[model samples]
Target: MLEQEKPLRLAAFDMDGTLLMPDHRLGEKTLSSLRQLAERRVTLVFATGRHYLEMKQILANIDIPGYLITGNGTRVHDLNGTLLHASNLPEESFKTLITHKWPTAASFHVFRDDGWVTNQDMPELLHAHQFSGFRYQLSELENISASGNSKVCFCAAHDELLALLPVLQTCFGDRLDFCFSAYDCLDVMPVGSNKGSALALLTDRLAISLSECMAFGDAMNDREMLESVGRGLVMGNALPQLKQQVAHLEVIGHCKDQAVSHFLQHWLNSPTLTYSPEY
Candidate 1:
């Protein structure tokens, strides 16, 4: 139980594994709870590793309005699709990424302002299309430039990705930041760009302090966001690496079980919810 001396004015959520269910739709129970929280004048912001267009598609049916931190925090946008802040990997970093000869089974993706590009036709690409609601154009690596690119991603089997991690880190460790948005997916963004920096930018723009925010996430990419917020709650399904490191983080029910909804419902209904965090 974390103490809340100041009222929680903002609730930031990571999309894929935090707010959305496995099928990518918000359960009625969770949807209702979020709506109610918004109705109470509490701000809701999505701090996710998803692309802007993908985030829009996922929230298409729901009318909940909030800020968006997409592309692993390389881009930040307001509800009306206005770009608040955006960052891109330098040409050198992009060159290094493109130069690498990834395994044939691995799919490389580059996100552009309007859409995304990929090099292979694999099941992972199809999964990306189904999940993101954005069709990608197939382009050769040599033709792909770093201009206007937000983030670069590599998708492979979970175990294969784990094996590839060390190589990637060694090659681009100083130039890029890496985070596992999912077990099978690794996102590489510009250094100093992540959910925490994005959230700080959003809060500064809105005149809110970190102490007045509550964040929820379930991946390694979400570590900074969870740690930066006044109250960071990890979904029961969070990565072992994140859970073990963020010792103060409180565990909630799994995302599939609507843990966020339950927790917010309790916070909205209880005025005396208080406990000091380990950090």
Candidate 2:
């Protein structure tokens, strides 16, 4: 049981398979849990690899208002559309990506403040959108030279992205951070841009301590975020390596809408558990 003096004040969720179910939709029970948590004054935040505009459409149906960490933490915004922070990649990094020895079958995406820009045509963009339903305003790569970008993404098979990571890291180094947000996609954003950093920024702004926060996730990108919070939960469907990172061995059930909702209801009703850092 958690000490009464230190209660959870915030809950951070990873969007894709963590919060949303296998069908790519939020379940009724999950929504109810969110409402219950809100009434208890626990801040709810959604952290995802998607951009704000893309996340808004899908989350519009929900009634709760909370902070959003989008573009894999490149930008942080509140529910009222207020921008709290953003980290944009340098122009040289973008230039380096465009000129890199990319896999012929791989496609790329660039996210800007106003909209998404991609050199590939709409068909290619559409294919990538299968993984993340982010709305984009496609542009030719030639016209993208002057645009400020927050992130660059490459969509291809896993092997393809793996083949490109070392080369990209070698060229850009500290200028960018790299990860696979989806099974077949590789994302590049400014250094220090990630869900954990965004969470830190939001927590600081809200005056919430790290020990009073809980987070949920299911992928490589979610690793740091899970490790950063007071109580980090990995979904039953998470990768083995990811599951090993959590301090608690408690296994939440499979990631159906019911599973997430059930766990939240139980946790909120249970006594807060004192956090013991594994690191």
Candidate 3:
């Protein structure tokens, strides 16, 4: 059987760029498709750089038991919000992230188990978190300890973040994973914590093989999970770097057009619909 013909037991999704509209709205068509998949006994996993609480609110439209791989996989929760696995960056990392001389445009945030705390609110971010009504607590970075936190984030202009990337890698690349969660946001999680590793743990516990799973994503953070699954589909709106990074993965329709919803519909009704050939 062609790889895509394999029995699909799980469908993993990355929010923001891959599963959500540019405005961060979850399309009705997408929710309906996920609900149908749940009814079919297919496991649904929403994995992203988002916090669990935020994801919970965003996914309120779907009433079913599913998994949440939040904080880019620093935290994983099961059916009833029971945490399956969690890894936290040490306090030192948080201090360094806070103290580092980031670009003047950078707005920093620390994500802990309780909630997020930011140095200041960047109004531009409102559009992305508005749908979930998730807001951060404003606090000085010095007071925010990284302990119990999944990741530290910095938001700025796209170019500024790109410039900061190599500097971060040079400082802590071996101890942590740095990736762009969005054009303006960079997330730094503990080295071993990521969507791909988290998915493997969840699937192993559920007795599902990697070959039975498919994933969708559109950013550098999604790279590991995309490559780990048997079938990885990259969104047409995926970051250009991501497309070049995972050239072997199939390219699919745009997220703004509800491409994931369309793909799920075809997977259920017509498995032979050809996806964009791998670039």
Point to the candidate with the largest lDDT: 3
TM-score of each: 0.92, 0.87, 0.94
How do all the candidates rank in terms of TM-score, highest first? 3, 1, 2
Tens digits of per-residue lDDT for model 2, 1-279: 234588989999997778888766677888899889999988989999877887776567566777899988988998787999988888877787776666547788888888777766656445434445665676767578644688888988888888888978787778789987877778987898889999999999999987788888887788778888877777778766567666464456666645667778767665455322221
Q: Is candidate 1 or candidate 2 better by lDDT?
A: 1
Tell me the spans in candidate 2 whose CA falls farther than 4 Å from its real position. Answer: 1-3, 121-134, 145-147, 244-250, 272-279
lDDT of 3 by residue, 139-182 (tens): 98777765788898888889988888888888886888888878
- Report lDDT (Cα) of residue 89, candidate 3: 87
lDDT of 1 by residue, 1-279 (tens): 334467878899987777888766677889898889889788889887767887777666577888889888899888788999989999888987898786536678898888778878665455544745677788897798768888988887888888777888888767888888998888888999999999999999999998899999999889999999888999888888888989788888777877788787777777576522222
Question: Clashing pairs in model 3?
Answer: none
Q: How well does model 2 score by local distance difference test?
A: 0.78
Top-scoring candidate (TM-score): 3
Q: lDDT of each model, Cα atoms only?
A: 0.82, 0.78, 0.85
| lDDT score of residue 139 within candidate 2 | 74
The residue pairs that clash in candidate 1, if any, are 2-275, 3-275
Model 1 clashes, total count? 2
For candidate 1, the lDDT comes to 0.82
